[model samples]
Target: MTVIVVLAMIFALLALRLFSVLGRRTGHEQQQIPAPADDRPAGARMPAGEQQDGRTPAQRAAESAVAVPAQAGLRALIAADRSFDVAQFLSGARAAYGMILEAFWKGDRETLKSLCDADVYAAFDAAITERESAGLTLDNKLVRIDTANIVDARVDDGVAHVAVHFEADLSAVTRDSSGAVVAGSLDDAVSTIETWTFSRDLRSRDPNWQLTETDEG
Candidate 1:
């Protein structure tokens, strides 16, 4: 019975020591473990220069608000074909009138060549050549030009036409028969209202719109 008690005590001591060693090993393992790194949050990241889907914000905006060249052409056709812009028509007439007046004053053949019709050019060239042959020179001193009215600006059978009334103050110089300069002075400035007609001359081949006639009063 004594030997049995001594064996039972030895078993209890062994169990207590084993339990203590297990507890110490578990504490040592926990202390040796490394800490977790602080990187970022959970979900995927959005890349730079890119929106939610794929395209950049600027690219998406440009795609939405862009004006295509074809659309611009269509808009121009609608504005021009639906109704003639009276202001634009008159602006063109004013330009043609200025071209003729300034071309005459400057004796610029190129400007006259571009604006005048063939018949009109023939008339003007004949007079100019005559003056040249006669040893005479001419100068037009223009003071002012007043545009009085735009009589008609219309589109007929795909042809756009506009007529305007213009008045100008002019001073002309005419030399006498002698080779020397004579009778060279500014004349009494007069205002004449001329009804000049013009046709639409868009930038294209066959762009020249011949002046049909003129009425001076």
Candidate 2:
């Protein structure tokens, strides 16, 4: 009976020691879990699809364009086309603006036809014809685009339209058929503000947007 009691006491001590070591191990493991990393910064509102700066990638894309007024329309566009990128679209718009201006100045109706809608193309074609009839040619250059911002956007009847306000410096000169400058000078750059609306059919397979309307801003 004494031997049995001694063996039982030894077993109890072993169990207590094992439990003590396990408790220490658990506390040590807890310390390894990073605290500050799991905790969000104070007063930060992190909505879904937003980053630490509190804006989504789409919003950031429109930052150069000041997108507050066009946010609702932009949202509608994004909802319709999941692959649409605002930044990429803005970049493309800038390029198109330059190309269209150059084409119109040089009377390249082919390029204008591809970039503009029927009505827009007709207007440019008429202007080009008039210039050719008058024996006048435009030697215009797009100096630089100062600003390009999406002022409005919407999707209607499966069509998406975005209006962009553009401020640019252009060097324009009109020359006679004999290669003599008739008006304007390349030394002076003219600052012009214009609004161009681009449209695309969401239901169509073609991803290109055409200039649908234009106005002076």
Give the number of the best model, judged by lDDT.
2
Q: Which stretches of candidate 2 lie over 4 Å from their true place?
A: 1-53, 56-61
Candidate 1 TM-score over all chains jointly: 0.50
- Model 2 lDDT, full chain set: 0.76
Question: Tens digit of lDDT per residue, candidate 2, span 164-188?
Answer: 8999999999999998999999999
For candidate 1, which ten residues in a row score worst on lDDT? 28-37
Per-residue lDDT over 106-215 for candidate 1, one digit per residue giving the tens place of the 0 to 100 score: 45666566566676666667777777777776655666776545554444555545455677776766764564546455756756678776554433235345454467
Per-candidate total of colliding backbone pairs: 0, 0
Worst 10 residues of 2 by lDDT: 26-35
